[model samples]
Target chain A: MTLFPRAVNETTSRELRKTFRSPSEIFYPLIFFVLVLTMFPFSIPPVPGLFNSIASGILWTAALLAISLSLETLFKADYSSGALEVIHLSGANLVLVAIGKSLGHWIISGLPIALLAFPIGWALDLNFLTLWVLVITLMLGSATMSLTGSSISALTVGLRGGGFLLVMLSLPFFVPLLIFGSSAATNASLGIVPEAELYFLGGMFVLSLTVAPWATAHAIKIRLG
Target chain B: MSKPILEVTNISLSRAQKLVVRDLSFSVSGGEILRLSGSNGSGKTTILRALAGLILPDNGKVARLEEKLGNITTSSNSVIYIAHRHGLEENLSPLENLNFLSQVCTPPPIRDGVSVLETLGLKTSMHVPTARLSAGQKQRISLARLLMFDAPLWLLDEPFTALDTSSKKQLESMIDAHLDRKGAVVLATHQRFNCKSHVLKHSLPMIP
Candidate 1:
C-alpha cells in the first residue's frame, strides 16, 4: 500500500517517455491530423461561415481518430513480455494499474496533439474563443478517447485480428462522444451556446470512467487465460 | 513442527467449456516436495494456476498458509507461480529482471540481485540482457527467482527444461535447503529428480 500509487505513477511516466522518445511515431499522427483537417477546407464549399459551421466537428472527429491511432502500443509490449502477469500477481489494484496505463497512453498520444492543435485551429479561420474552447475540449475529450481506446487495445492485445476488431468494437462507443464533441464545436461556430454540450460531454467522460477500466481488466484476464 | 502449508481438495478446472483437470486433489505439508508428473496437457499447468489462485476451479478447494484461499481470496501476494513461459521480461538482464520483480513484489532477502544470479551460475554474461542468454541461462534466471522469493510454496512448471547437469544439481541442493527451512515446493517436471525420500509423485493422465 505504501508503494502502489508511486509504482503506478512511475509506470505511467515511464510509458510516457518511451512513447515520446520515438519522434517518428510522435509527429506522424500530429501531421496526419493537420493534413486531414487541411483536406476539409478544400473539399467543402469555400464559404468561411459554412467551413466554420462544421469545422469544429471535423476537428473533433480528427482529434478522436488521432488518439485512436496509437492505442495498440499501450499494452502490446507489456502484455507480450509477461510484465502484465507480474503486475497482476503483485496484489496491486488492477483497476489503478488500468487507469495508470490508460493515463500513460493519453500523455503519449493525446495531450501533445491537442495542445498543438491551437495554432492549427487558428489557421483555419476559427473564432479565437472557439479555437481555445475547441483546444480545451479536444484535450479533455481525446484524453478520454485515448484512455478508452487503450482499454480496448489491452482487451485485444494478443487476440487474432485485434486491430480491425478494436475499431469494429470501439466505434459504437466513440459515436456518442463524437456527436456531442463536434456538436459543441458546431454550436460554438453558430453561437448556439456551449453549456449543454459541455454537460453532456462531462457525463460521457464520467460514464467512461466508471466502465472502461473494469472492462479492460476483465479483458486482460480473459486474454491472459 | 507446524501445520501443512497448503491443502487442496477435489479441485477441478475447465477452460473454454472443456474439462482440463477433473476431481484432482493433492496436498503438500510443510517442507515436503511434491512433483506433478504428466504428459503434455495433463493439467499440470492448470493445477499450478489453480493453486496460485490465478485460475478459479469450478469444484475444488485450495488453502495457502495464512490465506483464506478461494476464487476471490487469491489477491494475496505471498505465493509465486512461474509458468512454462517463465514469466520474465526478456529485454532485461537477470539482475535487471530481479530488480524489476522486487519493485513490484515482496522479495526474499538475497541482498543484491547479482548475488542471486551468482547462485544461479550466471557468469560474465550475467549482466547482458536476457535476450542474449541461452535457453539454459534464461531457465536458471527464472529459477533464480526462488532465491529471491521468501514464499514457502513454489509453483514451478518445467523448471528443468533447459538446465545443465550442474545447474540441475544446484536446483536439487536449493530444494534441499528450502525443505530444511520447512518451505514446500509444488512442481511440474518431466525430468527425473533423485530426491527419493522427500518426494511424493503424482502422475497425471492425458485423458483425465
Candidate 2:
C-alpha cells in the first residue's frame, strides 16, 4: 500500500490485449459453449418442464468450463516471446501486474460470456433469480479461475501439448468454484435461499484476489529463471 | 578515473544438474570490449545470461556501479542482452516487433523499424514477417536492438553469426561507437572481429 510503487498496469494490460486480439484465439470458446449446450438439448428428449428445472445448473456449468479453457492464454504467449522477462525487468510490482492482467481477462472473456449466457438462458427458459445468480456467480467465479489458472499456465508453458497439462494441473484448484457455481444456480431453481453458496463463492473470490496474483507473479519469475 | 564499472569476485554457474562454469573471476573497467571465444557448448551463452541477471550464478556476487556513480541500480537500462532467438513474435511484422519491444523495455531512444532494418541492410524486407526473413535477416532484426537501447553494457552471444561481410563491418563499427562512448561489452563469437585496439580476448575450454 506504499505510494512509492506506482500502480500503472500498462505492460500487463498491453500483453493481455494482444492475446485477446489474436486472430486464431477469438470466437472459439463462445462457439464451443453454444455447441456444447446444443448437445445437451439434443441428447435429452424435448420436455420443457425437465429442461426448465435443470436449466440453471447446466448453463452455469458450461460457462465455468468454457471460461477456464480461455484463461490458458494469460502467460503462455508472454513466456514464449521473452516478453515476460522484459516485464519483470521493467521494475513494476509483480502483484499489481498480475492483478491488472487478470482484471482485463475477466473483462474480455468473463463479462461477454455472462452477457452471451443470459440470452442462452432465455432460450432454456431460466427464471429471474437464476439469471442474475448465474451472471453474478460466473463473473466472480471466473476471476478465480483465471487468476489461479495463470499459475498453472506458467508452470506448463514449454511442455508439449500443454493445454491438457494445464487443465489437469488446475482442475483440482477449480473444483470448489465449479461446485458452488452449479449449486448456487441449482438451489435458486428450487426456490430456496442460495445465500450460503453465493457467500462462499464470494469468499473464494476474495481469497483468490488476495493471494493468486503473488503466486502467479512469482511462478513466472521462477519459470523464467 | 576511479573504481571499475563491474566487479566479479568469483562466479560459478550450474545449469540443471551439471556445473558448466566454475570459480572464474574477471573484471572490466568502463569502455572495455572483452571477447569470449570457444567451441560449441563452451558455456558462452550461460555466462552472458548470468551477466544480464537472467540466470543467477551459483556462488558469486555481481555489483554494478556504486551509488556515487550515478547508475540507475534497479533499472535494466545499464545493460542489454542479445541472442539468436530475437525473442520476437513471428506473427507480428518488424514494425509491430519494435512497438512490442518498446512497450516492455524502459525509456530509451526509440527508433523506427524501417531505419533499424536499413542500418542492418534489411531495408527491403522491413515489413515482412520475421519468419519469412532469412536467418541473417532475422539476426539483423535482433541486433536492431542496438539502435534503440543505449545501455552501457552489451552482453552479446554469437552476435556475428549468419551476417555477411558488410553486415559484419556494420556491427564492428557499431561496437566501436559503443566503446567510444565508454560502454563496455562481453562479446562471444566464433568468427573473428579482427579489431586490434582496445579489445580483450578470453578463451574458454569446451568441457567434455
Candidate 3:
C-alpha cells in the first residue's frame, strides 16, 4: 500500500519471478549439494557408523558451497541492467530491497538445502534426533549464509572475478555458522542437547539479518559511485 | 527564475583514478533544459550522476530546491535519474518494467501501464521481453520511466542514443513538455535538439 512496503514487495516478486523463470539457477546448486552429500559415503567407508560420523560435516560444507554458488546471480542482473541505479534514484529504501532480494534467494537456494538435509541425513544413516538437529541447524545456518552472502555478493557485483571474491569475502563469516551448525548435529548424535550451539547459530542468524541488508545497501552505493 | 531547482556548486568527480569533472558548477531552474555537450570522456555523465547524488563530489556540494517549503535540499529523492543503461530488466516485458518502476516512484503512477507504453510507441511489443526488442525500443522503454514518476529534477545521461529521427523528436517534445510543467532537466548527450524552453549548452573540458 505504502512506498516502502510496495517497493520491497516489488523487488521480492521480481527476484522470485527471475529465479523461477530459469529453474536451472535454483536446481544446479541443490543438485550439487545432493551430489556432494552422496559422494561422502563412497570416499569414506560405506559403513553406517562412518557415514553417520561425518554426515553433518558433509551437509554443512556442501550447503555452504551450494549457497555460495547461487550468490553470484544475486545482484548481477540488476546491476548490469542498471535497475539498481534506477531503484536508488526512485527513492526506494535500498535496505528494504536488499532484504527482500535476500529473502527470495534464501527461499530458492537456502530453504531447499535445509529441507533436504533431513532426507539426505537419513540416507547417510543419521538417527532421528541427529536428523532433527541437522535440519534445524541447517535452516538457521543456511538463512544466515544467504544473508551474509548477499552482502558479499553486493560488494563484489562491480568487480571482475566476483565469484571468487564472494567466496573469499564470505568464508570468514561462514566459519562461525559451520562450526556451530556441524557441532550442533554432532552433539545431538552424542546424546547431548546441543542447545547452546543452536542458540549461537540463531544469534548469528539474527545478527546477520540485522546487519547484512544495511551493509549490502552501503556496498551497492559504493559500487555505483 | 524561482530558485534553481537543482544546483551544482564547485563539484569535482573522479573516474578510473583520475579527476573527470574538476570544480564544475551549474544550475537548472524550472522550465529550463540544460544540455551537457562534450567530447568523449569529458565527464558529462559524471556531472549528471553527481546531481543525482549517485556520486559524492570530491569538493563542494549539489543542492536542490524543495518546491513546497522553498528550502534547498540535497537529498536524492528530489531527482529522477536515467543512466545510459536502459535499466529495464531484459527478461521483463515493457509493461512489466514500467510496473516495476511504478512501485518505487515518488508521486507514483495514476495512469494505466498499457497507455503509457502505447504513448511511447511500444504498444505492439509491450508484452515482449525487452531482450528481444531492438535498441531503439529499449531506449524508448527507458524513456517511458520518465512518465512513471514526478520529480522536480531529471538527470538523463545520453538519452538519445539509438533513437531514430521520429522517436528522437517525440522524446525531445516530451522533454519540452516536462520543462513546460516547471520541471528541470539535466541531459547529457551530443545529439543536437531544438526545443522551445530555455536551452543552455554547457560543454565539459576534456581531461588534460
Candidate 4:
C-alpha cells in the first residue's frame, strides 16, 4: 500500500483514541462553549429583538474562543511526551500528520460546537432558517479555525506560556471567519439569501484547508529545531 | 568490510545559540556500535539528534549510505531514534501504543507488539495504561521500538536510564542481536554496556 493514506489513517486514529481516552479533552471546550453561549442572554438587556439580531455574533464569538481553548493542548501533549519526535524520526510524512491532527481536532471540538450551536441558536430566539444557517456557518468557520489554529499551536508547541501566544496569534486570522460566519446567519435571519457570506466562509475554509497543514508541518520542524 | 551505514563529517551542533558539539566526526558500519559518553550538558543528545536528522548540523554533513545496485546512495529512512523521553502516551496501554507505532513507523514493524512486549517481560501489564507502569517498565516499552522497527541504524539516548539490572541486560542483548544482524547502533549513556560486541566510545567534551 502507498504510504500517504496509511500514515494519515493511523495518525488520525491514534489522535482520536488518545482524545477519547482522556475525557477532559473532549468535554472541556464543549462545556466552555455552552457556558459562553449561555452568558449572552443574562448579561445583555432582555430585548427579544436585540437578542435575535445579535445571536449569530454571540455564537460565532463563543465558537472562536472555544476552538482556541481546545487548541491550547493540541501539540503540547505530543511534544512533551516525545511522540512528536518519534513521529518525525519514524519517516512518517509530517504534512500528513498535521492534516490528520487537524481532522481529529475538528471532530472532537469543531463538530460538537457546530451541532450544539443549533439548539443554542434556537434558544437565543433564532428562526429555523437562521438556526440552520448558524449551524452551517459554524461548521465551516470552526473547521477553518481549527486548521489555522493547528499551525499556530504547532509553532508555539514548546514555548513557555504558549497558550496565550496561541490565542493572540490566531485571533486576527479568525476575525474574517467570524465576520463571514455571523453575517451569513444574520442575513438569513433577515430573510436575505446569505449566499455571499456563505461563499466567503467556504472560500476561507478551502484556503485554510490547503495551506494550514503544510504550515503546521513546517512549524513543527521549526519548533523541533 | 561492509560499507558504512552512516557517516558524519566535521559536524557542529549548537543549542540556544551555544555551541554544544564542535567539529565532531564519526561513522558506524554494520555489526558495530558507537557509544557517545559525556557528562551532563556535554551535547551527547544533541549529537544523536543531529545524526537522526531531527536537528540540522550548523556546519557539516551527516549522511546515511544505502547500497543500491552496487552504488551507494544517501538515505535518511534507515534510522530509528529514541530520545530521553519514553514517548509513551499516558492514557494508552503498552500494547495499544506499540500497535499504533507499528503501523506508523516506516517499513512497518517486522514483529508484532504483543510478542515484543512479552519478550520485554511486560506480558502481565501489557494492557495497563503506561502512566500506571513504573519508570523502568515505561523505559522498556520505549526500547520495545528497537525490536519493532527494522531500521538499520539506531540512535538511542539514555536507553539504560530507569531500567533494572535484568531489563538492562535484556536491552544489551537486544542491541547485540541487532548488531549481529548487520544493523548499527549509536547510543548515548552513562552505564557500561554489558554486551560482547566491541563498542567504540566517543566522549564529548564539555563546552564552556
TM per candidate comes to: 0.84, 0.84, 0.92, 0.94
What's the CA error at residue B18 for candidate 1, in Å? 2.0
Complex DockQ per candidate: 0.31, 0.32, 0.56, 0.54
Cα lDDT of model 4 by residue, A105-176, tens digit: 888999999999888777767888898898889889988988999999999887888889889999998999
- Alpha-carbon runs more than 4 Å astray in model 2: A1-9, A16-21, A38-52, A90-93, B67-74, B100-137, B164-166, B194-196
Report the candidate with higher TM-score, 2 versus 4.
4
For lDDT, the strongest prediction is 4
Q: Tell me the deviation in Å of residue A18 in model 3.
A: 0.8
Native contact fraction, candidates in order: 0.24, 0.28, 0.63, 0.63
Model 4 Cα lDDT, one tens digit per residue, B1-208? 7779988889888999999999998889999999999899999888887777767888888878653211212123577788999988888899988887777666667789999999999999999988899999999998887877778999889999999999988888888899999989999988877877899989889989
List the RMSD of every prediction in angstroms.
3.7, 4.2, 3.0, 3.1
Tens-place lDDT per residue, model 2, A98-211, is 776677677667777777877877777777777778888888888788777767777777779788888777888888988998899887767776899999999998998888
- Model 2 Cα RMSD, Å? 4.2
Task: Please state the error at residue B190 of candidate 2 in Å.
Answer: 1.8
TM-score of 2: 0.84
Q: What value of lDDT does candidate 3 attain over all alpha carbons?
A: 0.82
Error of 2 at B103 (Å): 4.3
**Model 1 Cα shift for residue A4 (angstroms):** 9.1
lDDT of 3 by residue, A120-180 (tens): 7887778889989988898888889888888889889968888888888888879989898
TM-score for chain A as predicted in candidate 1: 0.88
Between 1 and 3, whose DockQ is larger?
A: 3
Clashing pairs in 3: none
lDDT, model 2? 0.72
